[model samples]
Target: MAHLSSRRRHSRSPLKAFAAVAVVCAVAAGGAYAAGVGPFDRGSDAPAPAAADQARAFLADWSGGHYDRAAARTTNPSRARDVLRSFTAGLDIGKPRLTAAAAERTAGDRVRVAFTAKMPVTGLGTWVYKSHVPLQEQANGSWKVDWSLGLVHPHLSEKEKFRLERQDTAVPQVEDRNGKALTGKAYPSLQPLLAQFTDGGGRPRGSILLVDRVTGETKRTETTFGRQAGKGGEAGDAPVKTTLDAAWQSAADRALESGADGRNASLVALRVDNGEILAMANTPATGFNRAVSGTYAPGSTWKIVTSSALLLKNAVTPDTVVDCPKHLIVGKEFHNVETSEFRGATFQKDFTESCNTAFISLRGKLGGSELGDVARTYFGVGQEWHIGIPSYDGSVPRPADETEKAASMIGQGRIQANPLIMASVTATAASGRFHQPTIVLGSKDGTSTTPLPAAVVGRLRTMMRATVTGGTAHVLADLPGEIGAKTGTAEVAEGEENNGWLVAQRGNVAVACVVEQGVTGGGSAGPILHNLLSSVPGDPS
Candidate 1:
């Protein structure tokens, strides 16, 4: 009878068979649930209720930064976790939360999930972005999220990553002393502080999504890192007022770029009376600021300091006759440029002509520390300066031997200076006193030496004037300004070309320039100085 019943049941219609199977399944499920081993139990083989449900759970874990758990629910767990960590590293966004999610069925056993994420940005209020997550039914009958960069951000590609970085505040406009804007768009180097807030390629790490203080709408998005955040901020901050003169800056920029002729060059100008920076420019617009930070031999420019020491000691006067020779032997042989010597010329003539051997002959009259002392006191060499930026204070070490002393007198050997230091030296001669050069207003003032004697300064001015009128800087004599200048060709190697230098004072502006691998100061750097000085407005004469 039992066998007959079983046969009858098996022969029943499909609907009856299905009904019996359902009853068996329900009973088994109930028993498993009582034992905490049903489909919903941990590690159950049963699939998720829906693709949407699985996606939402994964998003919840991801949004909360539970990357391990979230990645485990993705098809590529290890790779997804690594990418997630990389994207979030250094990200400064607030705790992320899903604001909304919507799921739509795509192809068979696949679902597309679109969601909105909301997170707070530092100093930028709230940020919102959309993400798309795709879910597919796995071979195990469970739904797993298909990992992709788009899962992090829709705009991201497979090779890209998403991050919530701190946006640079809008940089304030940098203005000159006369309140004219020094636009980076016009001259990229004018943005001195830009590098502090940008990547290597000059791209801002973050952008400021500026909102109207009155209206809730976004005013604009700025990518520049300017003085908005203390000169390195985004665009909305107050304009940074600098001591730079825009016209002079433009002229300097032009002169340096064109005059360099493919060589590295830099120029810096300052007001003689107060040491306010008028212009600072460099060729090639490189990140390394050669104007202030460069260290090189001043060549004959060191004669300015040597002459100051001699004048202070009354060792020689402008009219005092000195012997000029083709060569002089101290510890080492020193010779004049081109072996052209001016025999029995006045000290003033020697200076104007830049007689290297003539200046070296005066070393016997100087004390061991005289040159260094004069350099520090009168020219501010080796003095610490705070110019609101990086800079090098020139070094004039006390010479240890006759060779070093002779070389030091001619701005060579161990002597080192930059365009800024040389410019300040000229400014001192122009003003009869020393004032540290400054680029930013209200910068800390460095110590100044005692004022030069009226007689010493008067003679120094006369010598410099002779330089323009009949000496190495004769090219600048016809310039409209009452100019006094010095030219230098610093020998860098035994046979290689020398570094050219020029320091000049026109009206109240003192300027200095240097060209690497240039053969002569007058030939390479004189025209540049003249171009810059000629561009100045008003009659300097």
Candidate 2:
């Protein structure tokens, strides 16, 4: 509105120009402060703090899947980059999220960054891991992270990378005598039994219990079979060999499965000449190996040991006559399985028929420890064994009273054996000497008594042979090869059901089978033994 407009405008330009210059300087100063470049300086010369900052930045990038960027902060950038890439690719987890990251000062211009990663595993939900990364300040005033495989996982080794893998390898297969596979194939009943030998990792070890018959050497091995997680620098398991006969094992499995009648049954077989196990099977194929570990009254099957003791003592010969009554009383009243009484029968005839009365009547003739000694020293009963697996060898305690002794004579009182022990008894009778049964090759041979008298053994063999031909085991008379057998119905209690048992020998193979709560030994267990023995390939006549 004044008349001097041009002069006024020219004069105000200097003041306005000065104000604009001052405003520009102030904005530049504020920007420099915000960037930590001027007044608030975090310069490269700060060694320890710089290293800590670099460590934090590296961890942040790593957790965010910026692997290349993260690795660029490491001393060995190329290797670090490759390792990071490979590890993340191999993981079965989702991208990791940084839960916490903190950098702390260490000695000599170094910094340690502790971090936690929250990763989601495919099916296992979330997994949290904590680790530390070390960083050092360089001479050039820069910081670099140390590259190590352990930076990823504490268990990782140098030249190794993290990888998600199975915990176990495949289970080792069980093999037969001819180097054929017995287990690992689909045998329904054997599956559960085989599981007992496996560990929580699902891995199976080589059968260390197998031994060579002629060499007396063992089949020991350090190899393991079954599923297990692979370690960083470790190899997988090797296959295992066994002493089982595949054919016989299969036959035994089938026999028990078919005849078990919802009850438990077990069977075991061994070579008479050498103690090599040929077959071991159980029905309801479970982790419990009843064939070798079961403890039950052996019943008349134990008469083999009793008779051996009596023969060694000259108490009675196979041809000697004995009385068989329907009922006899000692400390307790004892009765035979059959009501019919044979007033006078040869000892051989009574043994073939499994006459409990005849054997019980002679309990007074046995010395205090004679029967138990024979069982322990000659038959290897009730002895600890090293078979590369857990087993209950057997138990034969000396009876303290007449009633107990009478029951012991018939394999009742304080006399317990599994199928393996019974099979061993038959094998000993067949071989004319006691040889401890072994599943692992090269295991220590158990203690045994002096060689049995050949003449006495010869007569015992004849008596057992007559059982298959004309006695309780007559059902197996028509079987191929020279057969011998004995049947037993072990009374568990006065009123409870009895366990059926049968032991048999054919050529070199001897087998024993037991059926819990079965009708009778000859009726239930005899056929199973026959089935197993018949399947074995016999010697050429």
Candidate 3:
């Protein structure tokens, strides 16, 4: 009998809807993002016979993700329904459409067939939304569909459910670069605190799920039951090697607990090269992994996208100067910075200072759709990311008027982003290309690469570096090593400070921190970063 875990449950809600949004967001953002060839246009000329054969080969290569291989692919006559359910549910499939159809016959009188079917919910728009699947010829010379397409299921079997004991659970592990175990029992003393996680009403928020970044495995053992327990709760044997430093997580926890002033603070760090999240923290409320989940106004971080728009069009240069005097009136609206000193400044200066007026003045240089495209492509706003924890989709502010563009340039208007996305923008610049960022490393499906231009990344990196060295983030200059960062402060209701953000990268570690309703990002977030960096094993080197 196939052992099923007690926690196994099913939901009818569409699972692939999220993936569709992510795919559409990625494609929309990469706007005309030269495919290096062409869009997977289903309109290509009739596919050759070899193409059909190739499709069959492709089907055989996919490994199952959401189902137990032993159970899913079993030829056992007794478990046909179980296998069928496991395969179909694992597909996590929503509505699908046929994009292309073709067939061919190979040697030995076997028929081979290839067709592209799209999961409309994965967000490729109707145009590019199709997926290519290949079918092979059975012994009777009839084509049979491969089972890999069934990996889209919204629910998994009892064995595939996410749990510590489940053999199929494959989340990643977290450890320091020095080979020290930061997770598991060594320092899982916080599990008990996490188990007690709750809302103001004394209701359970949810179980704390520790994710392994390297393997994309989820270790979902129950959180520890008490504080100061002699031994840590079962932290689980399945370890995930993360890019985050253990000491940094500890420091970040203390900093958030002490300095948040009753509000919440979420911080995240990533490696530039591969989008590996280093350190992340959501304090005051331990269960909320706000780095991936919290959504708030981007403030100046949106400038990163606006800058890409300008560079992509070659309409402005780093040295381009303009007057940022107080505010610039655009079509009966006004744009200004928190400070009034930028009446006259250049693109480089405005960028370093994060001047709303200077950036807004350049709105006429690019259109709203163009700005959205760049924002979607380069910074990943409005995109759905596969970070281990849940994240929110940022609003790119489809401007209705030129003045709205001005507002967007200042990171206001309709713009909002979670800390997780901002960290991705910074890491893209640091990495010299745009790569998908994830909290859970080595995800089961892995990451997809987009060729964001090197020159575009370089230009943005230079601007961001100035912020840390001499502009808004200058306080970070005192840190042990060279750091690149930007700060954003937004105004919300009832005089609350709203959101304060600092996205930074030092050496291999890239980080983003958000303090909800903190007066200034530079003031509180800087020290948090300093302490986090200092606590890491290789600080100041």
Candidate 4:
């Protein structure tokens, strides 16, 4: 039965798909992602040459994930369907690749055919085995595969079946760029992500065995995707490598632990050059991975996009004077933090000071859909990103009302983001281009964004520099390096406390974090960002 599992029909009816390629192709390829190779017997003298062809076609339908089609080619259709489903589904062996040998000729009037199946056992290695089937002639002058319990597995009779049982569900070690094993205990913040780091959370990874039905005994041990190695049950899947830097991960964890003040918080750091995730950490680690999955209003950190839109449209320059009032009403009321007014301020001062009214006053300078369009086009907002893991790619829908538009100008209302999105946003602002953030370096990942204009990039960079040096993010100015940052305090509800946000880029690292209900971004998330930034070596991140 194990050997029979190896060869499946690679072609379909009339077997023209098998006309040229035959057993020779199957044996030559040696089954490394080899599928769809079929058998061709030209003018064979076997008494039931057509019967062998029927059996070959039956295996083809079976290996193609068409169980009912394969069963239709069998004499006992109902029984064949049930056993076939149980064998593949129960064993958790995926649609296997079957390599069929040419028809076997029996000296008498009967005919039989043999084949090999390369069954890819889920979360385990492939099990290669061979099996054979007898073909019988029907009254209608047609040949069909004889189906029985033994047809599914030679060892499986009417009283026996196959079982893939779990023995150890412990996940294998995850490695870093240097192949150093990274553990949850050594880096508690990564506990929530380690299992998924391998292949993004599927069936459990552990020791599994195929139980033989007759005696209920087991044979063979396993690994996942990785080649089988070692003696007995000691072998396992090779560790998957990620781009994470352990030292930066440790520093990011410590920063959150000490700076989050026991509040629910999440932080993420990535290389500004390639968008490779360096560290992802959450306080009170192990429940939810808010660092990448959670969504909240980015508050003022969204102003980065807002500034880009305004600059791209030539609405305002860094020195363009814009009025900042204690209260400015577009439809509803909007005000600066603490309702403190900067009577006459440049766009730079308004940005550094985080004046809600200052930015809201220019809402007329943008169309309701302009902001959302620019966000999706340049920032990858609302676009699919396959980061080798699941994540809620942020949403930035167009405003529904004047109030929503005013609120969105300051990163509220319908605008939503997490540390993951904001970290990428910061990276885009810093580099003038965008790269989809990815932890598993080999995962299918790439992005093409129209580069932010050079004039806009320079203005935004220096304006953010002023923010760190003389405005809201001054907490980071005293640390070191030329840094650009934005702070935000997002309103959740009328009575509830707001979520804080800060996203920035310094040297080669772009970092972002959120402290839920922590009041202001600078005061809450800034310290955490500071600690992480201070740890950035003079070398590349």
- Scored by TM-score, the top model is 4
Q: Which has the higher TM-score value, candidate number 1 or candidate number 3? A: 1
lDDT of 2 at 304: 85
lDDT of 3 by residue, 36-67 (tens): 11123243343334335334333221211112
Q: What is the C-alpha RMSD of each candidate to the true structure, in Å?
A: 28.6, 32.3, 15.4, 17.9
Candidate 2 structure quality by residue, lDDT tens digits, 201-304: 12232221223435644443212233233433222233334566677778788788777778888988888887777778877776556787666677788888
C-alpha TM-scores of all predictions = 0.62, 0.61, 0.58, 0.64
lDDT string, candidate 4, 1-541, tens digits: 0000001211111111121111110121112122222454555554465676677668767764567888898888898888787777777654455766666666444567777876656444356778876777778888778777666556666554455554444455777667778899999987756655543323234444445556766654433443222322222256767778888888889999999998888898888888888888988896456777665778888999999999999999999999888777666566666667787799999999988888988999999789878877888776767565545466665665777778788887646678888999888888888888887767675555677888888988998899899988888988777888988877654434667788888888888999877878888999998888887655343
lDDT of each: 0.67, 0.64, 0.51, 0.70
Give the Å shift of residue 514 in candidate 3: 1.2
- Which rank order by lDDT, best down to worst? 4, 1, 2, 3
Deviation in angstroms for 79 in model 1?
Answer: 39
Candidate 1, superposed: residue stretches over 4 Å from native: 1-172, 191-236, 539-541
Question: Alpha-carbon error at 227 in model 4, in Å?
Answer: 16
lDDT of 4 at 314: 97
lDDT of 1 by residue, 1-541 (tens): 0000111211211011111101010010011011111133223333334666667667656644567878998999999898776654434443344533445656777777776765433223234677777889888788899888778766555433343435433454567788887786676556554332222112233543444434545545523231334455344345666678877888888888778899878889888888888888877676556677666677787677788899999999999999888777776566766767888899999899898888888888998668878888877777777665545676565565676777778887556678888999998987789998877677787676888888888888889999999999898989875788899977664334667888998778889998876778998899898888877855222
Off by over 4 Å in 4: 1-169, 200-236, 539-541
